[model samples]
Target: MNQPGEDFYCDEALSGRTPVTVVAETADVLAFEHTRPFWPVHVVVVPKRHVPSLTDLGEADEALLGRVLAVVRQVAADVEREHGACRVLTNLGRYQDSKHLHFHVCSGAPRHPDTD
Candidate 1:
């Protein structure tokens, strides 16, 4: 679990600020749709607490981590049902921007042909 002194993004996605539709949520995790989707269907799953990064997760957060993964699986199943297929993604260190641990569930192919 995250405590004070940690700096991370708020649960803004839960409010549907992003392109997410909020599939489910728990004490520690949240699942939602992606606004500018990488694929036809894109969703982002995140931990509610403010963990600076995946590398910053503490011992007490082990269960929370497990729950996050479980939600990923459940959300992935839901995404597949809705979009036919899906991809699970997580970033580390420099690749992460929000500074909070989150997973992106992507489905279908890139919308723009110019994208690589």
Candidate 2:
């Protein structure tokens, strides 16, 4: 079973079918508030173009990868500046429920919501 907001970014956000609380965006990257945030300051950063995982990045994706990381860096800075500290991470292999390449920028305590 697909957990409520699991893979929500690919299933909805990227498709533009579901409105997201966007925090930042560039031509190739998007950083937005998690639809169902598990952490107090959870934000998702992704490339507008689908790339499966960080390990899957190829030479052809060099420019796109740079753009994605740039957005990730900025989002993390903003979060840390306000929240004191932040964690920037990406899930891989079995830990990655969503196949799309994305970075999680989070801080503070988790909200502990039932939906997540």
Candidate 3:
């Protein structure tokens, strides 16, 4: 039950309101299976803290971003290894449903038609 235009990661997942099946986790990042997956093998990597968007990062967020990307890399590698191929992506601006900086590591065809 995520609200539109809200930061699902910070407001739900990070806050422990929404339970997530963790794929990988680090000191500053969390990679988990998407609550509502768009692809067959879909995982999301996000920073523990609330960063508005990828483009909104400041100097203080560099280390955190690096950690987040590192987790994303590992998760993407795991998905690609098991699924043969995978896509790693992040949305920005109006394309982003949630105002949290998160990356999708996914493989296979879209589960929902509207996702494509």
lDDT of each: 0.73, 0.85, 0.87
lDDT at residue 96 of model 2 (Cα atoms): 91
Please list the Cα RMSD from the true structure of every candidate, rounded to 1 decimal place: 4.4, 3.8, 3.5
Candidate 2 contains a number of clashing pairs equal to: 0
Best of the two (2, 3) by TM-score: 3
Best by lDDT: 3
Query: Which stretches of candidate 1 lie above 4 Å from their native place?
Result: 1-8, 14-20, 58-60, 113-116
Which is better, 1 or 3, measured by lDDT?
3
- What value of lDDT does candidate 3 attain over all alpha carbons? 0.87
Rank the candidate models, highest TM-score first.
Answer: 3, 2, 1
Tens-place lDDT digits, model 1, residues 2-95: 3432323364554444444667888888887765667777778888765556677744377788899999999999888988888898888768
Candidate 2 lDDT for residue 98: 84
| Maximum-TM-score candidate | 3
The parts of candidate 2 lying over 4 Å away from their true place are 1-7, 58-60, 114-116
Worst 10 residues of 1 by lDDT: 2-11
**Looking at model 3, which ten-residue stretch has the lowest summed lDDT?**
1-10
Clashes per prediction?
3, 0, 0
